[model samples]
Target: MATDDGMRLAYYIVLLVVIGGAMLFELSGRGGKALRQLVLWVVIFAGAAFAAELWMNDGLGGRQTITSEGRIEIPASRDGHFHLTARLNGTDVRFIVDTGASSIALGPADARRIGIDPDDLAYVGSAMTANGQVQTAPVTIDELAIGDIVDRNVRAWVIDGELDGSLLGMSYLRTFARVSFENDLLVLER
Candidate 1:
């Protein structure tokens, strides 16, 4: 583990010990009832902690269901965004589904990870973003796949600005015959 992670774990352990000790001291006179209450509280705290950890790790919202009928269902995250994982040139890439975006736009890091050199690309194209206008470089993904669905020679752009993550925009979403929101899930049918 990294130094930061070790320190965080130690801090939580120390906090739990201190809290447990305080609870024990407060319940000393109550005997068996106090012990039961303490155990109950511990179980509740542990359950809450486990749930928080799952939410932080994207365990709850990162699940994508691909049906045999070529339909992909994505759950909306707690943050109210739909995220999907697709293979870009055979490399796994995570993207936030942005219907407002005209095309698939990759951040510098993602572009580099999928074997594209951002430094070598000429940023001749430009895009107007929420922040401002930013330079972009047009690139074609050799293969983009999500489950059994695959598209080749897909048009995309590399954004020359700070982007938290790559975007799965209308350019790619248009490939699906139907894109709809059912209940809380985003459904895309090819």
Candidate 2:
């Protein structure tokens, strides 16, 4: 695991354990404990629910499951990113669904995975990232699919720097008939 990811995991684990233990201790006693216990449980449950929200939002599992209604649902990751697996050019590429991004972004490695030779591409475009300005190369995905959803000839950029993973940006997400998040599920209906 990356150092950043490891640290985040440790942080959450400690937070949940501490909160849970406190809740249990509060529940063990009786008498004046009624309201206290209730409040404590509420706090504990809220903590857990918050953790769940972060997990589902992170999409660390990178798995998208089809619902009974034929919509796509992606649970969040621990770090609160909606990670999903998309088939790019018939090969599986893991992507973080990023609404903030204007278009799809593929890392150098992911560009190669989708059959683009990074070395041959000209990084004529630029995008501002959290790390500052970075060069980008325009590319196209012949096929990008998440669950049963599919888009062809999708426009994207290849990041010149080392990217943790590809980002599923508006270029593809906009194709969805409806996109919403409900009950911790990133719902996409076509």
Model 2 poorest ten-residue lDDT run = 53-62
**lDDT of each residue in 1-190, candidate 2, tens digit only:** 6464698678668777767766666767644767667668767776887668565554355557876565888877667777787789878888889999989999988889879999999999999887889999998789877656677898999999978788888877888789999877798887
Count clashing pairs, candidate 1. Answer: 0
Given candidate 2, what's the lDDT at residue 121? 92
lDDT (Cα, tens digit) per residue for candidate 1, span 1-190: 5364587577568657756775675566555766767766875676577568668646643678889899999988878899898999978898999999999999999999999999999999999988899999999999999988999999999999898789999989999999999987999999
Please tell me which predicted candidate would have the highest lDDT against the true structure.
Answer: 1
* Model 2 quality (TM-score): 0.65
State TM-scores per candidate.
0.73, 0.65
- Candidate 2 at 71: error in angstroms? 1.4
